[model samples]
Target: MRSPFDLSFRLKIPLWGSLLIVVTTLAISTSMMVQAYNDVRSDLVSSASSLGGTLAQTLFPAMLHDDVWQATEIIRASLHGGRESNVLRPELVFVLDREQKVFISSQPQTLPLLADIRQRGEEYRRLVDWIATDAGLETRSLELAKFHRIYVATPIVDTGAYLGTLVTVHSKEALLARFYSVAWRGLGIGLVVLAILLPINWFWGRRTAVPMVQLTNSIVDMAQGRASHLLPQNYTHRDELGRLFEAYELMVEFLQDRARLEQGMIRAERLAAIGRLSAGIAHEINNPLGGMLVALNNFRRRNGQDERALATVSMIERGLHQIHEIVNAMLVEAKGKARDFAPQDVEDIHQLLAAETRKCQVTLQIDSNIERPVPLRATLVRQILMNLTLNAIQASDRSGEVRCTIHIAGDQLLLHTENGGKTIPPEVVDHLFEPFVGNRESGHGLGLWIVYQIVTQQKGQISAESRGGVTQFTVNLPLGDPA
Candidate 1:
């Protein structure tokens, strides 16, 4: 709910991935089925050609000798028809002479002596047309595909002399039967492939999507200011998704750092506002206190003879003086010095932390390259550095490294301090800079409250993070106070 742009990757990946696989498989299966159909149909044509050529050779002697009985017997025997109507066989056979008169016929009654050959049927009319137009010696084939029948016309010749033609009719219903068988096999194969592959696809698709779902949930948690400890399960590849996991981790760390900084800025602003309000109240009270003290002195002088009145006047004067002192103290504290931050201030903090670092045996590396007096409060800057450096030194183990870097970038002065130590928990890091929130068991904190105060007063920002065995703090202070 924290992120509105969440995706249902778990459902989407498998649903779409399976769809893609099924579509691709079905396309491949369809292509294969079509090819099978062509093969079966081609086999029918080839059968016709081979059978007709043989019949032409067998009928050659019958025609040369004018033996019609032998040709008729050859035609009937070549049909290969079974007693059952469902048997696959040649549907018709005929031996016709060059004069377009049938010499022999399987269907003797319907196509008696070829009965002018062209008048047998509309399909045969087209068939004879093709055969008659061709050079008489060459073999030709006619396909009446819509009727599921084919005709192969082969010439019966004697020493290049034109003789009768042997025409064999083959049925493609047999091819359809074979194609249906192939299609069923293909369907079974496709179903088996889907049965095996779809589950794998579903499993792997969901597996791949798991990381994306976790990333989404992690984003939601981050948006709501919750720490996301989302480490992808066994995710170490350099693929696109792997890169995304790496990027997500980096993004989570970046957001955590930003959140800490913003929290620090907010707390500092609140404290700074409270300080300003207190100062304003002190100034307002001080203006009236002096007048009352003056009037008390004048009244005590005039009522000098009345002991009770004078006593009351003296007591009233003492109370006014006490009030005056308190107001003066508040006013003085409020008017902080506007000394510009200088390079020496960094050195002073380094010197102050040197003995502590030595005692802890921690290496303190300071990188302060500025030579000019920056337009920031020197005392406040020094205080922040001292507190951060001192705390880093204390947190670091023996022989551990503590680094502090200070530099100026454009309108702001940047400070970064870090220590190699145990990772501070998220709960502690949330309020690390808050007043009275103790990071260490022995103390309320590393003068972070004061650092927050300084940054807030300067209208700046501070953020801290403790993770990966490294505790770090960053502060950005405005170089010049706003008018």
Candidate 2:
């Protein structure tokens, strides 16, 4: 069972619109039917009264001449003649004598009742009672035993003496028929008008619904951080929907910006972690890196060209030893084991990088352009340069040259290294400065990470570029007091 007040559209708009149309039309139709019925009934009553008046007028002279019986015959003839020629087909009419006896009538059976009732004084008394009654007019409608009739009565007066009454009865069927026919015609026209308007209502309903659907979908997409297009100008009607569309667009832009900011923060956290890990290894590796550099410098200064050629026989062995030591220290540091930091000769960093690249056999030309000493933990710097040079060497083909240019500019020391490597892949270039972030087979990727840590802690800068067939890493550090 449906509730009386469900109030849903399926039950309301179409149903109710149709119902209202029907009900209003029916109400108007009913009113018209009633008015038509009344007008037709009134017309019948007026015709009856006019006929009665005319008959009374015609009978008045006969009554005045003491020819009441002759007046009675004339009444009968007129009643039969009027009834036979009438368009409305009146039911009956009768003329009563001064004593209230029905002397003549269109229907003969009605006369006996009129005369018998008067002889017993019932008809005469009723007639006198009606004439003296408060009702000044004697016109009424009656429904009697399957017949509906209008009654019009008038008194026949001659020389101020009441002679009799003239009464006529008209059937109500014709008037009722006219009322129903008018009602039917009115109903048909109302339906035609409703039919013309329904389609227009449906079209407007759809137009409103479609834009709301689009706006809802767009809002859902924006909520999920998915890209969504704006509503069409016309669709975003200059009303509440338009304001909602504009607000949604602004929300999307704000969320996109916020998402970018959050992503950048996460990346910064990761890079900072990498730097901390690199700083850990730089501590342990600095001492061994310093020892190795001192050894290399001592050997280079004492050994002549021929002796160096002899040592070159064991070059691969020497290079492997130096790389093995630095790598062990790097691995330990990357694991976050606590270690040390100390002042050391900067040449150690340069020498360690050269030693590691022997595996790649790239010609490394290192030229130091310095005015004062650069203060940094030598082992850490060595690990930094070794990782950078090794990556560059791997990028270069065999026999490719790697150049290291060390110089001072203003109050800073710089290490600029370039290798004959192909241009960096754009996909990886964006993450190049990130830790664990390089294209190398033996790459733990802590190389640039350590470099970044040392440079950051010392308040310096570092950058890499792989363009024009050259992969270059540049390191900048503040020059310290040389005592």
Instruction: Tell me, by lDDT, which candidate is best.
Output: 1
In angstroms, the error of model 2 at 100 is: 6.4
* Candidate 2 minimal-lDDT segment of 10 residues: 334-343
Worst 10 residues of 1 by lDDT: 326-335
lDDT per residue for candidate 1 within 1-483, as digits (tens), equals: 544235487978888888898999899999999999878767766777777778888888888889888988888787655555432357788877887788888988878874787777887778778877876676677888777776778888868887878887777776677788899999999999999999999999988888878877877887787868676464677899888888888987898889868865676666666557657887889778878888777776773368887888788888888777655543323246778888888888888888999999999999987788987778778878888888888899889999999989888899999999899999877767555565777654426766776676677878888889999999998878622
- List candidate 2 stretches off by more than 4 Å: 1-16, 45-56, 59-89, 95-103, 109-147, 157-164, 213-483
Clash totals, every prediction: 0, 2
C-alpha RMSD of each candidate structure in angstroms: 9.8, 12.8
Candidate 2 lands at a TM-score of 0.49
Residue-wise C-alpha lDDT for candidate 2, range 93-190, written one tens digit per residue: 66666565665566666455356434535433554455446334344333342445555677776556677666665655655666667767867876
